[model samples]
Target: MDSAVLSGRSLSRHFSVKGAAAPVEAVRDVTLEVAPGALTALVGPDGAGKTTLLRMAAGLLAPSGGSLSVLGVDVAARPQEVQDRISYMPQRFGLYEDLSVQENMDLYADLHGVPADVRRERFERLLHMTDLARFTSRPAGKLSGGMKQKLGLACTLVRLPELLLLDEPTVGVDPLSRRELWEIVRQLVEQERLSVIVSTSYMDEAERCQQVFVMHQGRLLAAGAPADLRSRAEGLSFTAVPRTGNSARTLQARLLDARDVVVDAVPEGGHVRFIRRPDASDGAVAQLLDGLPVNPVPARLEDGFMMLLRAAPPPPTLPTLPTSPTLPASPALTPPAASKPARAAGPAGGADSMIEVRDLVRKFGDFTAVASTSFSVARGEIFGLLGPNGAGKTTTFRMLCGLLPASSGFLQVAGVNLRHARAQARAKVGYVSQKFALYGNLTVRENLDFFGGAYGLYGQRLEQRTSQVLEEFQLGGQEHMPSGQLPGGFKQRLAMATGLLHEPEVLFLDEPTSGADPLARREFWRRITTLSEQGVTVVVTTHFMEEAEYCDRIVIQDAGKVLAIGTPREVRKQADDAGNMEDAFIRIVEQNRNGGAP
Candidate 1:
């Protein structure tokens, strides 16, 4: 048998909630093994015990039962021995915010007891691999989300180890950066024969691993190669596009409610896909999608996951409340026509010239966050800013929103110079930040009221708008729940609802669906399409290439410069690989990195 770099026998972990009297089972009876030179993925939704399992493997947490061994070292009895041979990076790895990139590397190297000469070579290779040599003197906190993730990975790789544990390494990273990180991992596995176990929510990333383990409510649901699991979903899926409005949410809700007929449903672009139980027949599926349009299609890893979770028997006892609430139901709003685009009022023409940036530049002393770059966004259009992490997308976004002053270049919004009428321009735009910008302590309704009032909404008008948003987002029943208590999907809905409360002409969303499930992402875009029907213009940034399909046009950037700009189809055509945006993005960014024209 292949050597087991890490092995666990019925491992489990229990934690006590601060206010709850009982200790919650974060991980339960998980039996698994990590083989040498293999990439194993631990996947589940948030709070599904992925982190708990990884921590236990790293000897950072003591399992309540079962046995764990790291390269023959018993984790519960000889944690120090296990730690000495493993490199573990938690979700929030200790990347010193105030320290320069090189300084932070040096600190970690010292802590790991790496020799000076060896550390020099390792650090040099890491810097080159992560493409951080150019920003060696930049502070860690100043780095973009993707850059920080890369730096964190680099620091952990400062020393060679038998096992590497990465806890949700690419959770908030952009697609380009995520690809780079995966490339590095692949290279390490080949060159060092490294055994790696990474926890992630992205099925695409998980599919690339040598093996996958699906966890739910702290128990192992399934484990195998991606293809193996996908094969298990055979003859269980079908696709259906909406005839009017956002049909995905309605389809998802309908299928979910029919527990006996359909096991799981996921919404892909333009369609809602489902997976039926093994015992389900074609007629049963037809009965489930009875009133909707449907077509048979192939099953994917996501479909398998949904089916497995849906079919798993519920635990004897109820699981503890998750860190967040479940995603909201889909809205029933109609999507606007795709042909007639809304134009923002501007000097160029009608709403088509809603925003104009001439030689836009933003610099911080000797460093430039955004070099001289220019672009425009039309009203009623979904405009996407695509780039690697720390590639100036946020800087450009900040400048357009008047949140940061540009060192040079002219920026006009709604036919007025942003510099001269910052507040007026802002008033016409809705902005959802990359971070959770809502009040966690306040209920969803309260947060909406606060934002509405800030936008000058009052009394009857505010009440009417709030009710409309609540209904549209399917949050009518949970308006009283604290925003902090909502799940990742619901929180996203609340954020979008708040942004649209003022009914601004242009909406700016920064990575709006980052860290959300595929179903949640599909539903989020559905609402955006609904708003577009009402003539709301949208400018957003995202790490998911699939999400780009929803956009009317996209702008690609790298290192503070524009690389490509066009419709999704047009931009994709520039790729040598044909239709794969992920491949296309990597090719474009890599070419630019090597000083080649996109």
Candidate 2:
């Protein structure tokens, strides 16, 4: 490993907490070598020390034990020199919202000592590569989520460093923007021979890297090529289709609950893709499938991840909650009432439509954020809104929720027009925001109590409901933990619990599982499917294309209008059978942007 660009021998870091009996080992006995000009990945769930490891490599955090050498330099003793040669982008990058895009880029360029000529040339190429050329004059604050991310990348690259480290770069980004960002990174790697180390929760992203390091609880669980990991799940991977009447999610839940036989279960293309535990009895396996046809499916990086996790020790606690009090809908999220209504509802959303939008338009000055979008969500449906970053999905969601006013169009929820009975209409729904908006200092129990009280739950009744939801989400044991200290999966469970406290007829989840791991994602969808079966209509917006498969119908929008809308299968067909949702989504958006098929 002498030729390795970055090498660590028994690398470890520890943090001391005031009340903890033992100092927390953020990184422990880790040994690895990263080759030059190669793309490598560190994959793990939140709180697994991925961030800590990245910080140590970038010379921002000193290791308590073991040795780390970067670019053949001792990082611990010469952190400043190491810092000058590597670019580190944390989960949250620093970008001035008040500054124009060009100004931000210029600031970074000046800081990095990029000369005038080099700055001009680099900015041109960087902006072009990031598809941000046209947006240079706009204020960074006004840019879409995806655009802001690209701009951040450009700022980092104003002057290249010897190594690039990105921490969960696409956490909350939409599917299309995610692919685009990767395209830029891939291009940089090929053209400049730059080396990159990225820590990600996405399995697909890991597959794209030359090597991956599987980490958990601050220890190196495994390391190898993607193919080697995939081989671990061979012979056990499968796709199980439901009987004529059963939905994929329902079947998936059944398998997941059968812990003795099922290893991992997810709904894909209206089918349950799962893996069986190697030691399960034949009868246990047969009973779990319930006579369904089991087709052998190729193992994936995600499958391998779950398999590896199953072999490891369980986390210190059961971190998932079955239910929690529903979080409050964001103020100003629901759009104002619709002046004109009465659109004929079809079988999908017509007269029976739980959520409806017709000829909807929202404008900001001369720019229309959402243009003439029309759709209907039938009762008990999981309706997904999909689009690239900066698309009008948020605009449409705001309008439907009555947080914003529609420029013009009819918007209805639960047969109630938002234009007029806003409060009444809002009363029928719950909302979970993309960001955790809870009071950090408060315990989970306190947050739940506060939210329940806001929903007018009080006295014994409020206590009863709060207690019930805590139990449901399996968070009763963690109720006293600080809300801010919860892991990614636990925080989401609490957020959703807060939203469901009142048991609203409709629930809105905006990127609910955006930064969650695969296990956390499966649990979220299981609850959603359960709610659908209980006759609650769910409207969700997510960047994870695979999550869309759990939806009964999905709407794809771009710029400011609906590009495609239908079942996942129908949308895929519309995109000329792109093979999968991500491909279909990209194909459809590209085609529509180019004035064609999509």
Candidate 3:
């Protein structure tokens, strides 16, 4: 404890709400130790107290019933002393939007009272490390999502504190940027001997840490090296390829529901990876699969985490949202008939191509945001659009949603040509933006009502559809709660519920699971699976490479150009038989950037 950079004992935090029955216990009797000059990770589902513990360590919040020491000093007794030696970056780092990148760094440096001589060297190194050297004069708001995160990290490091505390630093960052950020943190830990404790939702990031603390519902479930933690799931992990004529997600949903035999399940590499109950018979998982062959695979850190979470399950979340397959289709939501574009049928049981894009182009002044990209999405299929930040994924998504006009080429959604009937086409699809674009001030029900009306639903129809979605999305009780005060998972539910009120034939989701925890993400995907099974076409963009397995097919884009498009298996094969989608995606992107060199 004396040598530890930071240590806590029986830490607890509680917050009072105006209408709540009792104070919310954000953290409860948690004990932890973070080693010096090494990376430590805090990981768990949403509302797991990771952020609360980090804030307590940073002296921003006081623990209700425990002691925390930072660098051998008692944080509660002398928070100022601890604050002087540590730098804390919250999930939403305060970057002045109008300030230039260099200006933001300078502001942080000045606030920290960094010596002028030291600031110069530090700024130079950080700029080069973040690859923002050429963008120093660009306004922070003008930078891409990944670049903004990089700038926030650089700003946080302006003074080079002895300890660094980061709360979900890479929440909304793309994979390439996430890798770069980890590299920067690792370099600091190795070269500067700066100790870092970061909270992340990405299991892969936690795997890279020297120590990991798993939390659940305000308590520490386990703490150890990643390997030590992974041992808990040994011999219980397996990968089962779905039988012919079934999608990976369908199998995954089935496995996830069999709580008696399975702990967790997800689609990966065109197969379902699952964790079986230790006490279950060997044939339990096989029987669940209806005699499908199941091969045992090495357990991963994620497998262990899932096991822990299952042992201490959180509140019952949306297992599966109801899909109104029996409801009649609304005439106003029907797509206009248009000339068919010649294309092969897509997987996932779609009868016809619902989305057709050919030589699609979009430009902003002289810069092309999307350059002649082409792809097709089938009705009842889940199609993914993946790319690094600033790679034109959002721009392409906007064009498909009919929110923005394409510069040229053919584009259609739900049989309606986007160019000729943008409004009509918009009515046929539901769109959930990357950010929470709903009115935060409104109650959940109010936001639903407003959006429902905007979609042309009337008095009785609007009320009926709104009520149906509210119940199906498991947002029934939260209808009266202020949307902003809701938890992350609930906010996501509200957003998704709002998008589905009018029951559009096609749904477009842009990074819907960004910053969401494992439980929330699983629930979201389960709902998506149900929707697809009901013949609703789904188009989505995501940074989670594993999620690509859920898609019937995907298109990888970079710098406004399509690098690869195929099923996850085919894409992986193209990248030298990469073990997983993340590896395959990295290899393909790097290869293209390296001029197709192996």
Q: Which structure among the candidates has the greatest lDDT?
A: 3
Question: How many residue pairs clash per model?
Answer: 5, 31, 0
TM-scores of the candidates in the order shown: 0.79, 0.91, 0.92
A best-first ranking of the candidates according to their TM-score comes to 3, 2, 1
Error of 3 at 254 (Å): 2.1
Model 1, runs deviating above 4 Å: 1-3, 9-25, 62-81, 117-121, 124-147, 234-300, 306-349, 366-368, 371-374, 408-410, 414-417, 440-450, 457-487, 593-598
Alpha-carbon shift of residue 24 in model 3 (angstroms)? 1.5
Q: Output the TM-score of candidate 1.
A: 0.79
Write model 2 residue lDDT over 1-598, tens digit each, in one string: 8878789999899886433446667788999999889899999876678999899889999999999998889999999898889888888999999999999999988888889988889999998999888888899999888888888888988888889999999988887788889999999899999999999989999999999999988899999999999999999999998997666767887888787899999888667899999999889899777789989999999999999998889766633243433443322211111112323212475566788889999999999999999998987788999998888998889878878878888989987899888788877788898886677788889998988887777899878777767767767666666787676778887898888888777788989988787867876787777677667778999999999888888999999989899988889888887667888898988998888944
TM-score for candidate 2, please give it.
0.91
RMSD of each: 5.8, 5.8, 5.2
Worst 10 residues of 1 by lDDT: 340-349
lDDT of 1 by residue, 41-67 (tens): 988765578888888888889989998
Tens digits of per-residue lDDT, candidate 3, 445-556, equal: 8899999888898899888777677656666655666677677888887888788887888899999999887777887888887677667788999998888998888899
Instruction: Give the C-alpha miss distance for residue 467 in model 3, angstroms.
Output: 2.4
Better of 1 and 3 by lDDT: 3
Clashes of 1: 5
